[model samples]
Target: MIDKAKLSALAHAVIDTEIEAVKALHERINDDFMQACEFMLHCQGRVVVIGMGKSGHIGSKLAATLASTGTPAFFVHPGEASHGDLGMITDKDVVLALSNSGETSEILTILPLIKRLGIPFIAMTGRPESTLATCATAHIDVSVANEACPLGLAPTSSTTAALVMGDALAVALLETRGFTVEDFARSHPGGLLGRRLLLRVSDIMHTGDAIPTIDEEALISQALIEMSNKGLGMTAVVDDQYHILGVFTDGDLRRVLSQEINIHTEKLSAFMTRECKTGRADMLAAEALELMQRYKINALLIENEHQQLCGAINMHDLLRAGVV
Candidate 1:
Protein backbone atom coordinates (compact mmCIF):
# COMPACT_ATOMS: atom_id res chain seq x y z
CA MET A 1 0.00 0.00 0.00
CA ILE A 2 1.10 3.58 -0.66
CA ASP A 3 1.89 5.79 2.33
CA LYS A 4 -0.72 8.53 2.63
CA ALA A 5 1.77 11.06 4.05
CA LYS A 6 4.17 10.60 1.14
CA LEU A 7 1.32 10.93 -1.38
CA SER A 8 0.15 14.19 0.23
CA ALA A 9 3.65 15.70 0.15
CA LEU A 10 4.10 14.76 -3.50
CA ALA A 11 0.72 16.29 -4.43
CA HIS A 12 1.55 19.54 -2.65
CA ALA A 13 4.94 19.71 -4.28
CA VAL A 14 3.44 19.23 -7.74
CA ILE A 15 0.93 22.05 -7.15
CA ASP A 16 3.66 24.38 -5.88
CA THR A 17 5.88 23.63 -8.86
CA GLU A 18 3.11 24.31 -11.39
CA ILE A 19 2.14 27.54 -9.62
CA GLU A 20 5.71 28.86 -9.89
CA ALA A 21 5.83 27.80 -13.51
CA VAL A 22 2.77 29.89 -14.31
CA LYS A 23 4.04 32.86 -12.28
CA ALA A 24 7.33 32.80 -14.19
CA LEU A 25 5.38 33.37 -17.42
CA HIS A 26 4.54 36.97 -16.44
CA GLU A 27 7.99 38.28 -17.31
CA ARG A 28 7.99 36.53 -20.69
CA ILE A 29 4.94 38.50 -21.97
CA ASN A 30 7.00 40.89 -24.02
CA ASP A 31 7.38 42.19 -27.61
CA ASP A 32 6.89 38.75 -29.17
CA PHE A 33 3.63 38.32 -27.27
CA MET A 34 2.44 41.70 -28.53
CA GLN A 35 3.38 40.82 -32.12
CA ALA A 36 1.51 37.51 -31.85
CA CYS A 37 -1.65 39.21 -30.61
CA GLU A 38 -1.39 41.82 -33.40
CA PHE A 39 -1.13 39.14 -36.07
CA MET A 40 -4.19 37.30 -34.71
CA LEU A 41 -6.19 40.52 -34.32
CA HIS A 42 -5.61 41.60 -37.92
CA CYS A 43 -6.22 38.19 -39.46
CA GLN A 44 -9.25 38.13 -41.77
CA GLY A 45 -9.90 34.43 -41.08
CA ARG A 46 -9.77 32.11 -38.08
CA VAL A 47 -6.75 31.41 -35.84
CA VAL A 48 -5.86 27.73 -36.39
CA VAL A 49 -4.01 26.16 -33.47
CA ILE A 50 -1.86 23.08 -34.31
CA GLY A 51 -0.04 20.78 -31.89
CA MET A 52 1.05 17.22 -31.13
CA GLY A 53 0.88 14.88 -28.06
CA LYS A 54 0.38 16.63 -24.71
CA SER A 55 0.76 20.03 -26.37
CA GLY A 56 -2.34 19.18 -28.41
CA HIS A 57 -4.46 18.91 -25.24
CA ILE A 58 -3.36 22.36 -24.07
CA GLY A 59 -3.80 23.79 -27.55
CA SER A 60 -7.41 22.50 -27.70
CA LYS A 61 -8.28 24.35 -24.51
CA LEU A 62 -6.54 27.49 -25.80
CA ALA A 63 -8.58 27.40 -28.97
CA ALA A 64 -11.81 27.02 -26.96
CA THR A 65 -10.90 29.98 -24.73
CA LEU A 66 -10.10 32.14 -27.74
CA ALA A 67 -13.38 31.20 -29.47
CA SER A 68 -15.49 31.94 -26.39
CA THR A 69 -13.81 35.28 -25.67
CA GLY A 70 -13.93 37.18 -29.00
CA THR A 71 -11.14 35.64 -31.04
CA PRO A 72 -12.24 33.13 -33.69
CA ALA A 73 -10.11 29.99 -33.35
CA PHE A 74 -10.13 26.20 -33.71
CA PHE A 75 -7.69 23.35 -33.04
CA VAL A 76 -6.07 21.20 -35.77
CA HIS A 77 -3.85 18.21 -35.14
CA PRO A 78 -0.45 18.62 -36.79
CA GLY A 79 -0.59 14.99 -37.94
CA GLU A 80 -3.91 15.64 -39.67
CA ALA A 81 -2.57 18.86 -41.22
CA SER A 82 0.16 16.86 -42.94
CA HIS A 83 -2.39 14.23 -44.08
CA GLY A 84 -4.60 16.40 -46.35
CA ASP A 85 -6.25 18.43 -43.53
CA LEU A 86 -3.95 21.32 -44.44
CA GLY A 87 -6.63 22.39 -46.94
CA MET A 88 -8.73 23.55 -43.99
CA ILE A 89 -6.28 26.45 -43.46
CA THR A 90 -6.31 29.50 -45.74
CA ASP A 91 -3.82 32.25 -46.51
CA LYS A 92 -6.07 34.74 -44.68
CA ASP A 93 -5.86 32.65 -41.47
CA VAL A 94 -3.12 32.77 -38.80
CA VAL A 95 -1.35 29.58 -37.62
CA LEU A 96 -0.38 29.12 -33.95
CA ALA A 97 1.90 26.06 -33.66
CA LEU A 98 2.68 24.44 -30.30
CA SER A 99 5.57 22.03 -29.60
CA ASN A 100 7.23 22.25 -26.19
CA SER A 101 10.61 21.00 -27.53
CA GLY A 102 10.11 23.10 -30.69
CA GLU A 103 10.97 19.98 -32.67
CA THR A 104 7.78 17.95 -33.24
CA SER A 105 8.26 16.15 -36.58
CA GLU A 106 4.61 16.48 -37.61
CA ILE A 107 4.59 20.27 -37.09
CA LEU A 108 7.91 20.72 -38.92
CA THR A 109 6.46 18.71 -41.83
CA ILE A 110 3.83 21.41 -42.48
CA LEU A 111 6.15 24.45 -42.15
CA PRO A 112 6.85 24.61 -45.84
CA LEU A 113 3.18 24.61 -46.84
CA ILE A 114 2.33 27.22 -44.17
CA LYS A 115 5.20 29.37 -45.47
CA ARG A 116 4.20 28.80 -49.08
CA LEU A 117 0.61 29.91 -48.44
CA GLY A 118 1.95 33.16 -46.93
CA ILE A 119 -0.09 32.54 -43.75
CA PRO A 120 1.31 34.36 -40.70
CA PHE A 121 2.85 31.89 -38.18
CA ILE A 122 3.35 32.07 -34.40
CA ALA A 123 5.31 29.35 -32.59
CA MET A 124 5.19 28.47 -28.89
CA THR A 125 8.17 26.39 -27.83
CA GLY A 126 10.79 25.70 -25.13
CA ARG A 127 13.83 25.83 -27.42
CA PRO A 128 14.40 29.21 -29.06
CA GLU A 129 17.05 27.87 -31.46
CA SER A 130 14.84 25.00 -32.80
CA THR A 131 13.72 25.06 -36.44
CA LEU A 132 10.02 25.62 -35.55
CA ALA A 133 10.97 28.78 -33.60
CA THR A 134 13.50 30.05 -36.15
CA CYS A 135 11.15 29.90 -39.19
CA ALA A 136 8.06 31.47 -37.52
CA THR A 137 6.90 35.08 -37.65
CA ALA A 138 7.01 35.21 -33.80
CA HIS A 139 8.14 32.82 -31.05
CA ILE A 140 6.77 32.67 -27.48
CA ASP A 141 9.21 31.04 -25.07
CA VAL A 142 7.37 28.67 -22.67
CA SER A 143 10.53 27.16 -21.18
CA VAL A 144 10.26 25.82 -17.61
CA ALA A 145 13.31 25.25 -15.47
CA ASN A 146 12.17 21.77 -14.45
CA GLU A 147 9.35 19.28 -14.92
CA ALA A 148 7.14 18.53 -11.92
CA CYS A 149 7.51 14.83 -12.72
CA PRO A 150 10.27 13.21 -10.63
CA LEU A 151 11.21 11.05 -13.62
CA GLY A 152 11.47 14.14 -15.89
CA LEU A 153 9.61 12.12 -18.56
CA ALA A 154 6.05 13.49 -18.12
CA PRO A 155 4.88 16.93 -19.19
CA THR A 156 3.87 18.93 -16.13
CA SER A 157 5.36 22.40 -15.56
CA SER A 158 6.02 23.10 -19.23
CA THR A 159 2.40 22.41 -20.23
CA THR A 160 1.11 24.59 -17.40
CA ALA A 161 3.28 27.53 -18.49
CA ALA A 162 2.13 27.20 -22.10
CA LEU A 163 -1.56 27.07 -21.10
CA VAL A 164 -1.20 30.15 -18.90
CA MET A 165 0.48 32.05 -21.74
CA GLY A 166 -2.39 31.14 -24.05
CA ASP A 167 -4.89 32.48 -21.49
CA ALA A 168 -2.96 35.76 -21.21
CA LEU A 169 -3.01 36.18 -24.99
CA ALA A 170 -6.76 35.52 -25.24
CA VAL A 171 -7.57 37.98 -22.42
CA ALA A 172 -5.38 40.71 -23.90
CA LEU A 173 -7.13 40.31 -27.23
CA LEU A 174 -10.57 40.31 -25.56
CA GLU A 175 -9.85 43.68 -23.94
CA THR A 176 -8.28 45.20 -27.06
CA ARG A 177 -11.37 44.32 -29.10
CA GLY A 178 -13.71 46.03 -26.58
CA PHE A 179 -15.72 42.81 -26.20
CA THR A 180 -18.77 43.38 -24.00
CA VAL A 181 -20.82 41.07 -21.80
CA GLU A 182 -23.65 41.30 -24.34
CA ASP A 183 -21.26 40.12 -27.03
CA PHE A 184 -20.27 37.19 -24.85
CA ALA A 185 -23.93 36.37 -24.23
CA ARG A 186 -24.54 36.30 -27.97
CA SER A 187 -21.80 33.73 -28.34
CA HIS A 188 -23.28 31.66 -25.48
CA PRO A 189 -27.03 32.02 -25.93
CA GLY A 190 -27.80 28.69 -24.24
CA GLY A 191 -26.05 29.74 -21.02
CA LEU A 192 -27.51 31.41 -17.92
CA LEU A 193 -25.69 34.61 -18.79
CA GLY A 194 -27.60 34.86 -22.04
CA ARG A 195 -30.90 34.26 -20.27
CA ARG A 196 -30.16 37.10 -17.83
CA LEU A 197 -29.10 39.62 -20.48
CA LEU A 198 -31.47 38.71 -23.28
CA LEU A 199 -34.75 38.12 -21.45
CA ARG A 200 -36.83 41.31 -21.10
CA VAL A 201 -39.53 42.17 -18.54
CA SER A 202 -42.20 41.85 -21.23
CA ASP A 203 -41.01 38.37 -22.08
CA ILE A 204 -41.65 37.01 -18.58
CA MET A 205 -44.34 39.26 -17.14
CA HIS A 206 -48.04 38.35 -16.74
CA THR A 207 -50.19 40.60 -18.97
CA GLY A 208 -53.85 41.65 -19.13
CA ASP A 209 -56.18 39.42 -17.13
CA ALA A 210 -53.32 37.35 -15.82
CA ILE A 211 -51.96 40.31 -13.79
CA PRO A 212 -53.19 40.36 -10.17
CA THR A 213 -54.98 43.68 -9.87
CA ILE A 214 -57.83 45.14 -7.81
CA ASP A 215 -59.77 48.45 -8.02
CA GLU A 216 -58.38 51.08 -5.63
CA GLU A 217 -61.84 51.28 -3.99
CA ALA A 218 -61.93 47.53 -3.38
CA LEU A 219 -61.75 46.32 0.24
CA ILE A 220 -58.59 44.65 1.63
CA SER A 221 -60.50 41.33 1.58
CA GLN A 222 -61.12 41.75 -2.16
CA ALA A 223 -57.40 42.44 -2.81
CA LEU A 224 -56.62 39.22 -0.94
CA ILE A 225 -58.99 37.36 -3.26
CA GLU A 226 -57.25 38.77 -6.36
CA MET A 227 -53.81 37.85 -4.95
CA SER A 228 -55.00 34.31 -4.19
CA ASN A 229 -56.64 33.94 -7.61
CA LYS A 230 -53.45 34.93 -9.39
CA GLY A 231 -51.25 33.10 -6.82
CA LEU A 232 -48.71 35.95 -7.03
CA GLY A 233 -48.76 36.91 -3.27
CA MET A 234 -49.57 40.52 -4.25
CA THR A 235 -52.11 42.62 -6.11
CA ALA A 236 -51.95 45.99 -7.88
CA VAL A 237 -54.45 48.74 -6.88
CA VAL A 238 -55.42 50.58 -10.05
CA ASP A 239 -57.53 53.65 -10.89
CA ASP A 240 -60.61 53.64 -13.16
CA GLN A 241 -58.34 54.16 -16.20
CA TYR A 242 -56.27 51.07 -15.23
CA HIS A 243 -53.32 53.27 -14.15
CA ILE A 244 -51.61 51.87 -11.08
CA LEU A 245 -52.22 53.75 -7.86
CA GLY A 246 -50.54 51.44 -5.32
CA VAL A 247 -49.57 47.83 -4.55
CA PHE A 248 -51.07 45.69 -1.76
CA THR A 249 -49.19 42.62 -0.60
CA ASP A 250 -49.66 39.95 2.09
CA GLY A 251 -47.25 42.01 4.23
CA ASP A 252 -49.68 44.96 4.02
CA LEU A 253 -52.45 42.74 5.37
CA ARG A 254 -50.29 41.82 8.39
CA ARG A 255 -49.62 45.52 9.16
CA VAL A 256 -53.32 46.35 8.85
CA LEU A 257 -54.21 43.43 11.15
CA SER A 258 -51.78 44.77 13.78
CA GLN A 259 -53.87 47.98 13.91
CA GLU A 260 -57.13 45.96 14.29
CA ILE A 261 -58.46 47.51 11.07
CA ASN A 262 -61.39 45.63 9.56
CA ILE A 263 -60.30 43.89 6.36
CA HIS A 264 -63.92 44.03 5.26
CA THR A 265 -64.20 47.82 5.82
CA GLU A 266 -60.71 49.11 4.81
CA LYS A 267 -60.17 49.84 1.10
CA LEU A 268 -56.97 48.68 -0.61
CA SER A 269 -55.93 52.33 -1.18
CA ALA A 270 -56.05 52.95 2.60
CA PHE A 271 -53.18 50.51 3.45
CA MET A 272 -51.44 49.80 0.11
CA THR A 273 -47.91 51.10 -0.59
CA ARG A 274 -48.36 54.23 -2.70
CA GLU A 275 -44.72 54.56 -3.64
CA CYS A 276 -43.96 51.18 -5.24
CA LYS A 277 -41.28 50.11 -7.69
CA THR A 278 -42.25 50.18 -11.36
CA GLY A 279 -40.52 48.73 -14.43
CA ARG A 280 -40.65 49.15 -18.18
CA ALA A 281 -41.47 46.31 -20.53
CA ASP A 282 -38.29 46.79 -22.55
CA MET A 283 -36.06 46.65 -19.44
CA LEU A 284 -33.91 43.54 -19.00
CA ALA A 285 -35.13 41.04 -16.38
CA ALA A 286 -31.66 41.18 -14.79
CA GLU A 287 -32.09 44.94 -14.28
CA ALA A 288 -35.47 44.36 -12.66
CA LEU A 289 -33.85 41.85 -10.32
CA GLU A 290 -31.33 44.47 -9.18
CA LEU A 291 -34.12 46.98 -8.56
CA MET A 292 -36.05 44.40 -6.56
CA GLN A 293 -32.96 43.59 -4.48
CA ARG A 294 -32.19 47.24 -3.76
CA TYR A 295 -35.73 48.02 -2.61
CA LYS A 296 -36.17 44.78 -0.67
CA ILE A 297 -39.35 44.03 -2.61
CA ASN A 298 -40.43 40.96 -4.57
CA ALA A 299 -42.95 42.41 -7.01
CA LEU A 300 -42.91 45.17 -9.64
CA LEU A 301 -45.75 46.76 -11.68
CA ILE A 302 -44.90 47.22 -15.35
CA GLU A 303 -46.12 50.34 -17.20
CA ASN A 304 -46.31 51.08 -20.90
CA GLU A 305 -45.20 54.39 -22.49
CA HIS A 306 -48.53 55.98 -21.60
CA GLN A 307 -48.11 55.18 -17.88
CA GLN A 308 -50.88 52.58 -17.96
CA LEU A 309 -50.55 49.28 -16.12
CA CYS A 310 -49.68 46.67 -18.71
CA GLY A 311 -48.17 43.77 -16.71
CA ALA A 312 -46.70 42.59 -13.41
CA ILE A 313 -43.68 40.51 -12.32
CA ASN A 314 -42.51 39.01 -9.04
CA MET A 315 -39.33 37.27 -7.94
CA HIS A 316 -40.98 33.93 -8.71
CA ASP A 317 -41.33 34.87 -12.37
CA LEU A 318 -37.67 35.84 -12.64
CA LEU A 319 -36.73 32.62 -10.84
CA ARG A 320 -38.76 30.45 -13.19
CA ALA A 321 -37.23 32.18 -16.20
CA GLY A 322 -33.70 31.54 -14.84
CA VAL A 323 -33.01 35.28 -14.62
CA VAL A 324 -32.45 35.34 -10.86
Candidate 2:
Protein backbone atom coordinates (compact mmCIF):
# COMPACT_ATOMS: atom_id res chain seq x y z
CA MET A 1 0.00 0.00 0.00
CA ILE A 2 1.09 3.56 -0.77
CA ASP A 3 1.88 5.83 2.17
CA LYS A 4 -0.85 8.50 2.46
CA ALA A 5 1.54 10.88 4.26
CA LYS A 6 4.01 10.79 1.35
CA LEU A 7 1.23 11.32 -1.19
CA SER A 8 -0.04 14.41 0.64
CA ALA A 9 3.47 15.86 0.95
CA LEU A 10 4.06 15.42 -2.79
CA ALA A 11 0.76 17.14 -3.59
CA HIS A 12 1.68 20.11 -1.43
CA ALA A 13 5.07 20.38 -3.08
CA VAL A 14 3.48 20.41 -6.55
CA ILE A 15 1.13 23.23 -5.58
CA ASP A 16 3.99 25.22 -4.02
CA THR A 17 6.15 24.77 -7.14
CA GLU A 18 3.37 25.91 -9.53
CA ILE A 19 2.63 28.93 -7.32
CA GLU A 20 6.24 30.08 -7.59
CA ALA A 21 6.25 29.45 -11.34
CA VAL A 22 3.36 31.86 -11.87
CA LYS A 23 4.94 34.40 -9.50
CA ALA A 24 8.15 34.34 -11.56
CA LEU A 25 6.15 35.18 -14.70
CA HIS A 26 4.99 38.49 -13.17
CA GLU A 27 8.52 39.89 -13.28
CA ARG A 28 9.11 38.70 -16.88
CA ILE A 29 6.27 40.79 -18.36
CA ASN A 30 8.31 43.68 -19.74
CA ASP A 31 9.58 44.97 -23.10
CA ASP A 32 9.47 41.61 -24.94
CA PHE A 33 5.87 41.08 -23.87
CA MET A 34 4.86 44.48 -25.23
CA GLN A 35 6.72 43.81 -28.47
CA ALA A 36 4.82 40.53 -28.93
CA CYS A 37 1.49 42.32 -28.46
CA GLU A 38 2.57 45.05 -30.89
CA PHE A 39 3.48 42.41 -33.48
CA MET A 40 0.09 40.66 -33.32
CA LEU A 41 -1.83 43.96 -33.18
CA HIS A 42 -0.13 45.18 -36.35
CA CYS A 43 -0.47 41.90 -38.25
CA GLN A 44 -2.76 42.13 -41.29
CA GLY A 45 -3.45 38.38 -41.35
CA ARG A 46 -4.43 35.85 -38.68
CA VAL A 47 -2.04 35.02 -35.84
CA VAL A 48 -0.90 31.39 -36.22
CA VAL A 49 -0.07 29.56 -32.99
CA ILE A 50 2.11 26.45 -33.41
CA GLY A 51 3.33 23.91 -30.86
CA MET A 52 4.31 20.26 -30.45
CA GLY A 53 2.98 17.57 -28.07
CA LYS A 54 1.50 18.85 -24.78
CA SER A 55 2.35 22.43 -25.68
CA GLY A 56 0.08 22.10 -28.74
CA HIS A 57 -2.92 21.40 -26.44
CA ILE A 58 -2.22 24.60 -24.50
CA GLY A 59 -1.52 26.49 -27.72
CA SER A 60 -4.95 25.60 -29.15
CA LYS A 61 -6.67 27.12 -26.08
CA LEU A 62 -4.45 30.20 -26.26
CA ALA A 63 -5.29 30.71 -29.92
CA ALA A 64 -8.99 30.44 -29.15
CA THR A 65 -8.73 33.02 -26.34
CA LEU A 66 -6.91 35.46 -28.62
CA ALA A 67 -9.43 35.01 -31.44
CA SER A 68 -12.45 35.44 -29.17
CA THR A 69 -10.90 38.52 -27.54
CA GLY A 70 -10.60 40.49 -30.84
CA THR A 71 -7.27 39.18 -32.06
CA PRO A 72 -7.65 37.06 -35.18
CA ALA A 73 -5.73 33.86 -34.38
CA PHE A 74 -5.81 30.06 -34.85
CA PHE A 75 -3.63 27.11 -33.87
CA VAL A 76 -1.55 25.17 -36.42
CA HIS A 77 0.12 21.93 -35.38
CA PRO A 78 3.83 22.12 -36.12
CA GLY A 79 3.97 18.51 -37.40
CA GLU A 80 1.05 19.20 -39.71
CA ALA A 81 2.65 22.43 -40.89
CA SER A 82 5.76 20.55 -42.01
CA HIS A 83 3.48 18.43 -44.25
CA GLY A 84 1.75 21.15 -46.37
CA ASP A 85 -0.16 22.83 -43.47
CA LEU A 86 2.48 25.54 -43.80
CA GLY A 87 0.41 26.82 -46.78
CA MET A 88 -1.91 28.43 -44.23
CA ILE A 89 0.87 30.74 -43.05
CA THR A 90 1.25 33.97 -45.04
CA ASP A 91 3.69 36.90 -44.98
CA LYS A 92 0.99 39.05 -43.42
CA ASP A 93 0.44 36.69 -40.47
CA VAL A 94 2.35 36.46 -37.19
CA VAL A 95 3.49 33.11 -35.75
CA LEU A 96 3.42 32.38 -32.00
CA ALA A 97 5.38 29.18 -31.38
CA LEU A 98 5.61 27.39 -28.03
CA SER A 99 8.26 24.93 -26.80
CA ASN A 100 9.14 24.80 -23.12
CA SER A 101 12.63 23.43 -23.86
CA GLY A 102 12.87 25.60 -27.03
CA GLU A 103 14.01 22.41 -28.83
CA THR A 104 10.94 20.53 -30.10
CA SER A 105 12.15 18.78 -33.26
CA GLU A 106 8.75 18.94 -35.01
CA ILE A 107 8.51 22.72 -34.51
CA LEU A 108 12.15 23.24 -35.54
CA THR A 109 11.47 21.48 -38.88
CA ILE A 110 8.98 24.21 -39.87
CA LEU A 111 11.20 27.14 -38.85
CA PRO A 112 12.76 27.46 -42.31
CA LEU A 113 9.39 27.72 -44.08
CA ILE A 114 8.13 30.26 -41.50
CA LYS A 115 11.30 32.26 -42.16
CA ARG A 116 10.88 31.91 -45.95
CA LEU A 117 7.34 33.32 -45.70
CA GLY A 118 8.81 36.41 -43.97
CA ILE A 119 6.13 36.28 -41.25
CA PRO A 120 7.06 37.79 -37.89
CA PHE A 121 7.42 35.20 -35.07
CA ILE A 122 7.17 35.24 -31.27
CA ALA A 123 8.81 32.38 -29.35
CA MET A 124 7.73 31.16 -25.89
CA THR A 125 10.49 28.97 -24.45
CA GLY A 126 12.49 28.22 -21.30
CA ARG A 127 15.86 28.78 -22.90
CA PRO A 128 16.51 32.14 -24.57
CA GLU A 129 19.67 30.73 -26.19
CA SER A 130 17.83 27.94 -28.03
CA THR A 131 17.54 28.01 -31.83
CA LEU A 132 13.80 28.79 -31.82
CA ALA A 133 14.40 31.76 -29.50
CA THR A 134 17.38 32.94 -31.63
CA CYS A 135 15.16 33.00 -34.77
CA ALA A 136 12.19 34.69 -33.14
CA THR A 137 11.60 38.45 -33.32
CA ALA A 138 10.40 38.44 -29.70
CA HIS A 139 11.08 35.81 -27.02
CA ILE A 140 8.83 35.31 -24.00
CA ASP A 141 10.71 33.34 -21.36
CA VAL A 142 8.40 30.93 -19.48
CA SER A 143 11.10 29.10 -17.52
CA VAL A 144 10.34 27.36 -14.25
CA ALA A 145 13.29 26.60 -12.00
CA ASN A 146 12.26 22.95 -11.81
CA GLU A 147 9.43 20.61 -12.79
CA ALA A 148 6.91 19.80 -10.09
CA CYS A 149 7.22 16.12 -11.05
CA PRO A 150 9.39 14.15 -8.61
CA LEU A 151 10.86 12.23 -11.57
CA GLY A 152 11.46 15.47 -13.49
CA LEU A 153 10.00 13.72 -16.55
CA ALA A 154 6.41 15.08 -16.53
CA PRO A 155 5.48 18.51 -17.88
CA THR A 156 3.72 20.01 -14.86
CA SER A 157 4.90 23.38 -13.56
CA SER A 158 6.24 24.26 -17.02
CA THR A 159 2.88 23.80 -18.74
CA THR A 160 1.12 25.89 -16.08
CA ALA A 161 3.56 28.75 -16.64
CA ALA A 162 3.06 28.62 -20.40
CA LEU A 163 -0.76 28.66 -20.03
CA VAL A 164 -0.60 31.67 -17.70
CA MET A 165 1.71 33.50 -20.11
CA GLY A 166 -0.72 32.77 -22.94
CA ASP A 167 -3.57 34.28 -20.90
CA ALA A 168 -1.50 37.37 -20.13
CA LEU A 169 -0.76 37.86 -23.81
CA ALA A 170 -4.42 37.55 -24.82
CA VAL A 171 -5.57 40.04 -22.11
CA ALA A 172 -2.82 42.54 -23.00
CA LEU A 173 -3.77 42.43 -26.66
CA LEU A 174 -7.45 42.78 -25.73
CA GLU A 175 -6.77 45.97 -23.74
CA THR A 176 -4.41 47.46 -26.35
CA ARG A 177 -7.06 46.97 -29.05
CA GLY A 178 -9.67 48.63 -26.81
CA PHE A 179 -11.87 45.55 -27.12
CA THR A 180 -15.21 46.16 -25.42
CA VAL A 181 -17.81 43.85 -23.91
CA GLU A 182 -19.90 44.49 -27.04
CA ASP A 183 -17.02 43.26 -29.14
CA PHE A 184 -16.80 40.15 -26.98
CA ALA A 185 -20.56 39.66 -27.27
CA ARG A 186 -20.27 39.78 -31.06
CA SER A 187 -17.90 36.82 -30.94
CA HIS A 188 -19.95 34.87 -28.40
CA PRO A 189 -23.50 35.58 -29.54
CA GLY A 190 -24.79 32.09 -28.71
CA GLY A 191 -23.49 32.20 -25.13
CA LEU A 192 -25.30 33.61 -22.06
CA LEU A 193 -22.97 36.59 -21.64
CA GLY A 194 -23.46 37.52 -25.30
CA ARG A 195 -27.25 37.31 -24.95
CA ARG A 196 -27.16 39.59 -21.90
CA LEU A 197 -25.11 42.25 -23.67
CA LEU A 198 -26.62 42.04 -27.16
CA LEU A 199 -30.33 41.46 -26.57
CA ARG A 200 -32.07 44.88 -26.40
CA VAL A 201 -35.49 45.88 -24.97
CA SER A 202 -36.82 46.42 -28.48
CA ASP A 203 -36.25 42.78 -29.33
CA ILE A 204 -38.37 41.42 -26.47
CA MET A 205 -40.92 44.21 -25.72
CA HIS A 206 -44.62 43.69 -26.43
CA THR A 207 -46.09 46.18 -28.89
CA GLY A 208 -49.38 46.93 -30.64
CA ASP A 209 -52.07 44.40 -29.69
CA ALA A 210 -49.79 42.56 -27.28
CA ILE A 211 -49.22 45.64 -25.09
CA PRO A 212 -51.80 46.20 -22.32
CA THR A 213 -52.87 49.81 -22.59
CA ILE A 214 -55.84 52.11 -21.88
CA ASP A 215 -56.79 55.77 -22.37
CA GLU A 216 -56.24 58.14 -19.38
CA GLU A 217 -59.96 58.70 -18.94
CA ALA A 218 -60.70 54.93 -19.05
CA LEU A 219 -62.42 53.49 -15.97
CA ILE A 220 -60.30 51.43 -13.53
CA SER A 221 -62.43 48.38 -14.36
CA GLN A 222 -61.68 48.79 -18.08
CA ALA A 223 -57.93 49.16 -17.37
CA LEU A 224 -58.05 46.04 -15.18
CA ILE A 225 -59.67 44.16 -18.09
CA GLU A 226 -56.83 45.24 -20.43
CA MET A 227 -54.23 44.15 -17.86
CA SER A 228 -55.87 40.71 -17.43
CA ASN A 229 -56.30 40.26 -21.20
CA LYS A 230 -52.62 41.06 -21.89
CA GLY A 231 -51.49 39.03 -18.79
CA LEU A 232 -48.73 41.56 -17.90
CA GLY A 233 -50.28 42.49 -14.52
CA MET A 234 -50.22 46.16 -15.61
CA THR A 235 -51.64 48.62 -18.17
CA ALA A 236 -50.14 51.82 -19.58
CA VAL A 237 -52.42 54.87 -19.61
CA VAL A 238 -51.95 57.02 -22.73
CA ASP A 239 -53.04 60.54 -23.80
CA ASP A 240 -54.71 61.67 -27.06
CA GLN A 241 -51.38 61.33 -28.94
CA TYR A 242 -50.67 57.84 -27.42
CA HIS A 243 -48.02 59.39 -25.17
CA ILE A 244 -47.67 57.68 -21.81
CA LEU A 245 -49.48 59.66 -19.02
CA GLY A 246 -49.30 57.05 -16.26
CA VAL A 247 -49.12 53.33 -15.48
CA PHE A 248 -51.58 51.16 -13.49
CA THR A 249 -50.19 48.01 -11.93
CA ASP A 250 -51.52 45.27 -9.63
CA GLY A 251 -49.66 46.98 -6.76
CA ASP A 252 -51.65 50.14 -7.28
CA LEU A 253 -54.89 48.14 -7.39
CA ARG A 254 -54.00 46.56 -4.03
CA ARG A 255 -53.29 50.02 -2.52
CA VAL A 256 -56.61 51.40 -3.82
CA LEU A 257 -58.45 48.37 -2.47
CA SER A 258 -56.90 48.93 1.02
CA GLN A 259 -58.20 52.52 0.97
CA GLU A 260 -61.63 51.20 -0.18
CA ILE A 261 -61.51 53.43 -3.32
CA ASN A 262 -64.53 52.68 -5.51
CA ILE A 263 -62.98 50.80 -8.46
CA HIS A 264 -66.20 51.19 -10.48
CA THR A 265 -66.46 54.94 -9.89
CA GLU A 266 -62.78 55.90 -10.47
CA LYS A 267 -60.93 56.53 -13.76
CA LEU A 268 -57.43 54.92 -14.32
CA SER A 269 -55.87 58.45 -14.36
CA ALA A 270 -57.02 58.97 -10.74
CA PHE A 271 -55.21 55.86 -9.40
CA MET A 272 -52.33 55.24 -11.83
CA THR A 273 -48.67 56.02 -10.97
CA ARG A 274 -47.85 59.32 -12.71
CA GLU A 275 -44.01 59.36 -12.55
CA CYS A 276 -43.62 55.68 -13.50
CA LYS A 277 -40.22 54.37 -14.49
CA THR A 278 -39.91 53.86 -18.26
CA GLY A 279 -37.32 52.54 -20.68
CA ARG A 280 -36.25 53.35 -24.23
CA ALA A 281 -36.82 50.79 -26.98
CA ASP A 282 -33.09 50.76 -27.81
CA MET A 283 -31.90 50.16 -24.24
CA LEU A 284 -30.22 46.84 -23.47
CA ALA A 285 -32.51 44.31 -21.80
CA ALA A 286 -29.82 43.87 -19.14
CA GLU A 287 -29.95 47.60 -18.38
CA ALA A 288 -33.73 47.44 -18.11
CA LEU A 289 -33.42 44.51 -15.72
CA GLU A 290 -31.05 46.55 -13.55
CA LEU A 291 -33.48 49.48 -13.45
CA MET A 292 -36.31 47.18 -12.47
CA GLN A 293 -34.26 45.67 -9.66
CA ARG A 294 -33.08 49.06 -8.42
CA TYR A 295 -36.60 50.56 -8.32
CA LYS A 296 -38.19 47.38 -6.85
CA ILE A 297 -40.55 47.38 -9.84
CA ASN A 298 -41.12 45.02 -12.74
CA ALA A 299 -43.08 46.41 -15.72
CA LEU A 300 -41.82 49.27 -17.89
CA LEU A 301 -43.36 51.28 -20.74
CA ILE A 302 -41.08 51.74 -23.73
CA GLU A 303 -41.11 55.24 -25.22
CA ASN A 304 -39.36 57.38 -27.82
CA GLU A 305 -38.06 60.96 -27.64
CA HIS A 306 -41.67 62.22 -28.14
CA GLN A 307 -42.74 60.14 -25.08
CA GLN A 308 -45.10 58.08 -27.25
CA LEU A 309 -45.70 54.55 -26.02
CA CYS A 310 -44.03 52.27 -28.53
CA GLY A 311 -44.14 49.07 -26.46
CA ALA A 312 -43.86 47.56 -22.97
CA ILE A 313 -41.58 45.04 -21.19
CA ASN A 314 -41.41 43.44 -17.76
CA MET A 315 -39.13 41.23 -15.68
CA HIS A 316 -40.64 38.32 -17.58
CA ASP A 317 -39.46 39.87 -20.83
CA LEU A 318 -35.91 40.12 -19.48
CA LEU A 319 -36.01 36.45 -18.39
CA ARG A 320 -37.38 35.35 -21.75
CA ALA A 321 -34.74 37.41 -23.57
CA GLY A 322 -31.96 35.70 -21.49
CA VAL A 323 -30.97 39.08 -20.02
CA VAL A 324 -31.57 38.06 -16.36
Among residues 3 or more apart in sequence or in different chains, the pairs in candidate 2 whose N, CA or C atoms overlap within 3 Å are: none
CA lDDT, candidate 1, residue 293: 98
Q: List model 2 lDDT by residue over 1-324, tens digit each.
A: 999999999899999999999999998898999899899999999999999888999999999999999999999999988889999999999999999989999989989888888888899998989999988999999999989998988999999999999999999889989999989999998889998889888999998999898998888888888999999989998887988888999999998889888888898887899999999999988888888999999898999999899999988878877777
Candidate 1 lowest-lDDT run of ten? 261-270
Worst 10 residues of 2 by lDDT: 315-324
The TM-score obtained by model 1 is: 0.86
TM-score of each: 0.86, 0.88
Q: Per-candidate RMSD vs. true structure?
A: 2.8, 2.6
